[model samples]
Target: MNKILIIDDDHGYRDVVSIAARKKNWEAYTSPTWRNVQHQIAEKKFSLIIADYRLRNETIIELLDYMKREKFSFQ
Candidate 1:
């Protein structure tokens, strides 16, 4: 199964994405905070990561930089 990670502070948005992913037979995981998302990344391998451009605690650019430093690959 394909695993996907959805990162956003908006609960509704996460739910919507999760539901859509499930309909397509993909496993969806969500995180409301950057720290939580980071932990999730460390714990599992996701085929895709969909993140909000502006999170409550971090911007997308900052998150991308961190991911690069940590050697996390995402399309």
Candidate 2:
């Protein structure tokens, strides 16, 4: 199963994605807290990431930076 990470501050959106990922047999992890999300990425390896265009504490740029630094590709 592929691992997918979703970073969003919306509960409803997270739940919907979680359900969809499960249906596809993908492991999904979500966080409304940006700090936690970043920390998790450092410790876990995810095949794909689905981040919201906006976040409460961190912007898309921050996420993009992490992705770039980690050499994560769209594939």
Candidate 3:
């Protein structure tokens, strides 16, 4: 099964996306903290990444920065 990474601060969004991802037979992982995102990406590869524009401690800008530094590919 394909895996998806959801980077968002809202629980509601995560839950809704998780349900949809599961229904489509994909594994969904969510993270609200920036630190966890690093670890998760390091440990597993995700086929897709859906991120919110804003997060608790950082914005999507920082997310882009991290992705560039880590060379993570997202669809």
> Who wins the TM-score comparison?
1
lDDT of 2: 0.81
Candidate ranking under TM-score, highest first, comes to 1, 3, 2
TM-scores, all candidates, are 0.86, 0.80, 0.84
Query: lDDT tens digits, residues 1-75, model 1?
Result: 889999899999999999999999998998887677677776677899888899886787887888788898643
Residue 15, candidate 2: how far off, in angstroms? 0.3
lDDT of each: 0.85, 0.81, 0.82
Best by lDDT: 1
lDDT of 2 by residue, 1-75 (tens): 788888889999999998999899999998886567776777777888888878886787887787688775542
Whole-model lDDT for model 3 versus the true structure? 0.82
What's the candidate order when arranged by decreasing lDDT?
1, 3, 2
Clashes of each: 0, 0, 0
Q: Which segments of model 1 are wrong by more than 4 Å?
A: none
Clashes of 2: 0
Candidate 1: residue 57 lDDT (0-100): 66
Sliding window of 10 residues with minimal summed lDDT for model 1:
34-43
RMSD of each: 1.7, 2.1, 1.8
Candidate 3 residue lDDT tens string, 1-75: 799988888889899999999999999998876567787776787898888887887787886788788887743
